[model samples]
Target: MFEKLKDLKTYEAGKPIELVVREFGIEPKDIIKLASNENPYGPPPKAIEKVKNLASEMHRYPDDSFFELKEGLSSKFNISASNIIIGAGSDQILEFAVHAISPKKVLMAGITFAMYEIYSKQVGAQILKTESVTHNLEEFYEIYKEQKPEIIFLCVPNNPLGECVDAKEVFDFIEKIDENTLVVVDGAYQEFAAHKDKNKEIKPEDILKYKNVLYTGTFSKAYGLGGMRVGYGIANEYIIENLHKLRPPFNITTLSLAAAIEALKDEEFVKNSIIKNFEEMEKYVSFAKENNLKYIDSYTNFIVLYIKNSTQIAENLLKKGIIVRNMASYGFEALRITIGTPEQNDKLLNTLKGMIS
Candidate 1:
């Protein structure tokens, strides 16, 4: 019976350090994983201390509505709590968006995050993939007119590729789309986007301009809170209300909510993380230039480099106790590596230099 379930495709996740250690018989301490774009600095000290203090109350269930977390985010973004909804992570909110609107046709870029395709299939939607080496608004508009999709997913500062659509262009595209269609801007990497004006960061007020627009973000990347899985979405209260109807009660844990509240208040943590990412990105760029390897300019915490035999390169690196992402699944001859601390970046660059030589 299991064999007859042929409507499935495998989703490849970043290989865990422990699993790689066992597979290659290497010491975990010796491995340098540049695969997932995680904050190397870890969570802020204040957030860690707060969670530790909250640990004693483990027996109590968390607020199912995530009221405090939502309140904090709402205050920061200047939106009513009614317009916000928290989840285990922004990925869950992305899944909710797909589930709510994409019962049939879904549209996304060909090289966007894998989760978009995964969730599309899960909801039994036909994913219409478009090609984009860059986010040319005209190209997107052309496809939008043809597809007339119920839901269009846009990952600004697109993953793996790390290119974002300009704000004015994105707004223009939204204006042209049919009012009945829902347009979602996935901002998982928005924290690192290099908008000329810093104010380009998505604000709750921005989401209100377009009734069909929904913006999602997470604390996993810049906040160094991946393990906690806290993320949220902003939209008109109507859409948020509908999402609340579909979301599971108590989907987020108490500790996660507590940690996120502290994390949001630690503005210094976010500032330092962005500064560190930029510094590390420069080093990666220098390494790529010195080695004569082609790569994409990134506004995110990871950079993608084009290389022949990316899978073979990854396999060899794994044996050497270095882990990097291979883009074989996304049909690109490239690898994506997270920008780590300066020390970790040096180690990764040194290892890559030797491998390529």
Candidate 2:
């Protein structure tokens, strides 16, 4: 009965604070979770208030059109509402793309966002991966010429590893591909990448000009709305129209829509979160250096440190009321730690010091 799902491996998210509480008998208040690349500062103040105000509207369904949220996104990106498609999260958008395209062959990085491979497998498509751990356009081109994959996924400022490819390099690579091949640029960490390096920025407007390119973004990271589950894809009107067909009615909740709409209006909150993220990231970098540990120079809200015994260290940290992502599942002996607030970062660093030493 579950034919297509037989080989599929479920995506394992970062250990949640609640899970740590249940498993280790640690109080939620005492646990500092650096596992998920979530905004440790919490959601935007305005978004929080909006969600509270929207609490009474839970009985009603969200607008299927999602016109208001789309409009806010339209104005922000200078793109028409027709060019966008909202999803439960950017990962949902990835699913929509995979289903809509129904590709025979899919291409992605050797190590990238797991959803790319997971969704492709669901559709029974053959998956092709580049040899390099990070995005390499030349290697991608070589594979593209030989395999002619139907869809390509580029995760900028890629997760787990934290390295980014130049936007121009990405565009150049996309330009060489035929119009029939779809290229999905997963920019879940785009805001952080842009803030860290101007060369890494890939604007929605620019992406829209390419008919085959779909740029996906999420409010879960820099926008501090991880709990809201709001994300979107920007492309030409034709691609958005097709993706809409696969979208379920009211895929997101009323409160989530309200939270995202309010979150979009508070640019200052997003800005400050990004600013603090990098500032706190510097501390992690310094800590890595002090311990003589090698780490990827991250452009996202998290950093990945190459450790000799990451799994043991991560477990030890959990016992001390700190939770970090051990990248063992991704085939790396490293830890992907979300950059947290100053106090939170300090606590994590101190805890890590005792473990590593």
Q: Pick by lDDT: which candidate is best?
A: 2
Find the 10 residues in a row with the least total lDDT in model 1.
194-203
lDDT of 2 by residue, 109-195 (tens): 999999899999988999999989889889999999999999999999798789999999999998999999999999999999999
Query: Candidate 1 on 7-57: residue-level lDDT in tens?
Result: 657667778899888899899788888888888899988889998999988
Each candidate's TM vs. the true structure?
A: 0.95, 0.98
Taking every candidate in turn, the Cα RMSD to the unseen true structure, in Å, is 1.9, 1.0
Model 1 accuracy (lDDT, Cα):
0.83
User: What range of 10 consecutive residues in model 2 has the weakest lDDT sum?
Assistant: 323-332
lDDT of each: 0.83, 0.92
**Candidate 2 residue-pair clash tally:** 0
Cα misplacement distance, residue 182 of candidate 2 (Å): 0.3
